[model samples]
Target: MMRLSRKAWNNVVIISMLLMIFFFNGLHKKLNTQPVEEGVQALLPEQSFILAMAFPELKIERIGTSWRSQSQQETTWQGNEQQLEQLVELWQHQKLTIANLPVSKISQTSADYVASVWLAGEQLPAVYQLYNIDQQYYLLDKRLQRVFELEQADAAKLFPLYPF
Candidate 1:
């Protein structure tokens, strides 16, 4: 067996510890923001803007907190990550990037906004709901009449889900 001096042993131990910490930190950091559970791209502009309305700062700040709060609130009413993932997919497909959507106006102290956006070359109406603390946006499926609740839409059937 090879023997090492005390100084060399200490140096090796310190280097190994430092390397371990760096490797673990990088690995965990990426996992923390894992791409919205697959099949969901980045938020589009109009949708991002609309979503931003749910946050008091308009998605400019505290976005993570807002998202978490929104998830909790919706989940309390039977919403789940599946629905949120589907919604995110739809938003990505809609070609709505955050940069293209801007808050037209904030109506009073409420989180909703009057925003101008172009869809198929026409202006549209978009509404955003803020979490209780004005942190995150609660994305509702208006067609289903559910606010913040997530449910898979039926293709061949017509049924509406409502949020309480």
Candidate 2:
């Protein structure tokens, strides 16, 4: 039997312990790190001057904390400023990722809608397409890359209809 010397065994144990510590440290970091969307800057909710959503049947807009909707309804629907602000904040801080599928190839359905966020002085708005495919809602950037997964209920809140 080729038995290792006591000193040799001690060295092996120390090396094993060091490797285990490193592995755990790496795992801890991986678990704790926030999932941030790469290649995109965080959108500032506070700096947003206008928000709009366009659908095949109607259009909704929020300007300076006031909400208006143009549809077949006789009265324009108004929204709560506090709720709208919170929604903006939620979108600003939500974690997103680069889509695995290309935006051009994303299958669109009849329920899809286009949303835009405009900064204080920007001539063009940052556009996103919200799609409901197979019951899951996805938010795709203007370039057609899927950026965020959203709940259907939350998406509905963006275009609430006021009961006449």
Winner by TM-score:
2
Worst 10 residues of 2 by lDDT: 155-164
Best-matching candidate per lDDT: 2
1-164: candidate 2 lDDT, tens digit per residue: 76999999999999999999999999999999867546544434344555664444455567655655555445344445565555555555554444455555565444366656654576776676766666776677663344555566656654344121
Pick out the ten consecutive residues of candidate 1 with the lowest summed lDDT: 154-163
Candidate 2: where are CA atoms >4 Å away?
1-77, 107-111, 143-146, 157-164
Q: Each model's TM-score? A: 0.27, 0.47
Please list the C-alpha lDDT of all candidates, in the order they appear.
0.35, 0.58
- Candidate 1 per-residue lDDT over residues 1-164, each given as its tens digit: 76999999999999999999999999999888644322322333333333321222112112442332242132223324454344434543442112111233222245332211223332453433322223333333222222342122321011112222
